[model samples]
Target: MRGSGQIVNRRRMIAGAGAAVLGTLLPGGAGAGRATDNALLPKLTDGRHWRIGYAETMPYGNYAGTLASIVKGLDALSWLNGAARMPYDAGQTDSQALWRWLSAHDLGPRIRFVADGWYGGLDQAPAEPILQRLESGGDIDLMIVMGTIAGRKLAVDRHSVPTLVFSTTNAVAAGIVAAAEQSGRDHVWAHVDPQRYYRQLRIFHETFGFRRLGIAYENSPAGRAIASIADIEAMAGQLGYELVARHVQAPAGPDDQERYYADLAAAWSDLAQRVDAMYITFGRWSLDRFPALVRVFQERGIPTFSQLGPEEVAQGALMSVARGDFDGIGQFGASVIARLANGERLADMRQIYFDTPTIAWNLAVASRMGYRPAMSALLAADNIYTSLRAVP
Candidate 1:
């Protein structure tokens, strides 16, 4: 693994383009490194602040949390990493870092944070309320939809403003857009990773030779669509393995939370004994239960894998294929929004997907599970954790 100093240098390099773009957007053209002429830059009409709305399927869940991190990362780039030096001690989640940056910086006067909403675990946020808040008065110029469910509904409802969908496992399968290359909607563009799961599964099989893989599936339309099990099944069959899956029920209300964890724990107990390894799917209910689920699998000596990111692997998963640069997503999304705000047609914009995937490994969990990844796998890991603690 690279030294701390090397990693920091790499991060700055990866953030260079983003920081430059953000510099052009800051007040008074402060950090405008290349383009000093204000006329050449994009700006809101009449100096009106650009209002961006944030919507997620499960705002408090892991996927949403990661999306929030991407936003903070953008804020850091906007300020040339000045927000990172702020004295405030942000929480572990990206949402906290975003809150801190918003409080400490003058980003609001030029770029404002608008309506924030989340569809409950059951995909209950209908189109009317979303459209009413965003499209009714033209209060919001752009909306960032976090997951497939929220993006699907917003697209189906025909939101009038430009929309950027992020972190969706599969936009094509969910019918958010006709094809990744061509987003059938003029007002929407999305970032989709259709092969994330396939890549992770292939890596796990080649690394550990896990034949019977166990997974927890959420019972929801979005869950059914994104990361379809049929895809996993076909991949597993070709790879000479079997997929053992259990349907996990989504919590209908607050009272069902405890029961939901209990049911997941029970399922994990049975699955651990049968499967050689475990794969976690993108489900709000399943993700919420990760801490408990990771503990259960760890205790049973089962190596767990996921496509979520490095954070999950650090928490307890044996390994993961994570999005290489978290900040890059925010940077790219910001550029798209900047163009749209500058009168560029949304139909002319193409959807973006992260092609750089990094391997992350948790040596502590691998040791506990009595599994040794091949030397090649270890050498390929971009991020490695020796302890089962959150990545700071």
Candidate 2:
């Protein structure tokens, strides 16, 4: 459940060309150096005040928490790094709301905020407002987008402001760029190792014996980037488990949450003939509905495996194997954008992400599903988290 104080922000864009021009008008340039640099000294370029826009999608899953942490990290960087200012209200929900907050606020030249594009309605964050603002006096040097919520493919517009894509998936596959090593002159994707997903699969095999795997993913570039289950099909092949990947679209309505549960139950129930156990994905929809699926797993007598991250572990996810630190991703994004804000050419900069897998086990879920693994496995369990349903 999202906490009471957890806040979100979003924006929209209309015509791409218009938005590009608007971006160019803004201060799409700032200076940022390595994390070790002295906050007082400039490492790359001496750019003052950062003009930045944040685009984060898929906040519905266990993702809201990460946004909160990112805000905290950005705040820390602003003070310690002697960084430029960031745009917007600390917790306001929209660009207009943020603008209202900024008008009377005293953020100084060190901050510039565009807006988060996720929270707004479709096409609501019209790009020209940004472009006009830039033309009229915008100082945002870089825009950080989480996942390609941008929908269509976007190329680098040297004539306009450059965009730094932090899309969770590999930028290469999305055709965002020519290769992982190089995106456009301005755009580059942070690299996520395909091998990492494979490692998690191996861990799941250690627990579930690798039966037919049941995977679910929303049709989003970011969700697929984490684990396409296609690129790493070889992982399942090596484990000798039949792969049943279901591409789930977002629920049409709140009532459809039940349909999501039904769809998941059917994934395992229908495939139970072939798959003795299942691996649910960390997709936006699946990860958000974990507890429901956990109940389904218990009802069906199948062990479920997950590798999304630590937060899921706390929520009764059987296990999450990937490294996702919101603070780390935030700091990395801020530093890179800060560099862009400082007029860095953005060519060939290294991709950075925090990767540290923390395992969480719901002892009661394990026992309820009759998932008594090797005694040694149980003994070796780390962070045996308890669910309300867990055996006391």
Candidate 3:
């Protein structure tokens, strides 16, 4: 039998060896006479320096995390200054801070960040102007789009600019891409893990054996994608658990964010009365409210799993499955960007990539629920929090 270390090494070899392995399979790759001397450096096909722009659904921690990791990956690949670091915390939901950092940072001679090009919250920002900028093509060589709303808007046939979509809950379900194998648009590529939520739900169910599971999400199309309701329902059918779901109004504006959370608070409070366990889905609510949000679940001794990541677990959720670090996903995305800049066709490149999952367990939250995890489970956790962080 193969050792656990052997299995892990094999997975890394399959997933993390992104550039070399993928290049061989795709068109205009190493075998197709693609240039390599300047491949790691960012440049346009016409020998002009690359200028990159960015867009997002809103100010989100996941976007911040994905951007930071991509920047770090580019630096490591020598495409940017390895000595520099992004200024904002990936755990914070501040897009302006990230834009300021990008504007000031020396990203190296190979690429330039268009200072006026960053946009946030597609729901609030007018889509036409953003679409026009991307369609111009000469304004920026590539657009780093984060989140489902922006991805759907920017990654259409109407705009021919190279667009890379990241940080979405499920890109395929959101209709940002056609499928995991291909993006179905010439200038679009998305990083996707179609089964990520399914894996999370399965892990949660197997651990706690909950007879009824609860979830909350917005009722709209975008909200369903974020909550992964289809995946949740499919898992329920297989695992023999009843699903209890609630819909809270999605914030209409920045000012409405508080009301949205209030609605969520009420929904979860109602759910707490009916469910065996709760699955906390993603929303734009400020992380500060996490402690209070999970307080109802804790008061009732219900186990909660956060869909966002271990960051939420650190705040208050009981457990989650997360990549041990963002490095692997970052490297995967960076390789795709570098290759695209090097003149590889986005259509030829593969879009499916999966992070090797590790358990993130919070001992304090578990203790509060009067649950003691198995010794083997405790030993397997990649991140174990002894206490919850103070609410920000």
- Best-fitting candidate, scored by lDDT: 3
Candidate 2's residue-wise lDDT over 38-67, tens digit each? Answer: 432224334456555544443423233333
Write candidate 1's Cα lDDT for 1-392 as tens digits: 33221122222333444334323222222111221233224565576766666666654334444455445544543422344544332113334345445445565445666524333332554567877776574677767777777777776545577777877777887878777665776788887555566766776776678778898877566667765666678788789888888887866566777787787778778898888788876654433346556876776787788756665665677778744444456555655565666677766765644544556777778787777766555545556777654323
Q: Could you give candidate 3's per-residue lDDT for residues 1-392 as a string of tens digits?
A: 12111112222333334323323322221111122445656664554667889999887767777787787778877777843557755356776677777767777777677888888878556679888777776678888999877887888887788899997888888888888888887898998877788778877887889999999998888889877778888989999999998989888887887898889899999999999999998877766678888888987999999988877777788988756556667777888888887878888887767655666777788888888988656545656677765543
**Against the true structure, whose TM-score is highest?**
3
Model 1 residue pairs with clashes: none
Which should have the higher lDDT, number 1 or number 2? Answer: 1
TM-score of structure candidate 1 = 0.75
Residue 90 displacement (Å), model 3: 6.6
- Candidate 1 regions exceeding 4 Å error are 1-48, 59-105, 108-110, 115-128, 285-291, 388-392
> TM per model?
0.75, 0.66, 0.83
**Of 1 and 3, the candidate ranking higher by lDDT:** 3
Q: What is the lDDT of candidate 3?
A: 0.76
- For each candidate, what is the lDDT? 0.61, 0.48, 0.76
Q: Which is better, 2 or 3, measured by lDDT?
A: 3
> lDDT of candidate 1?
0.61
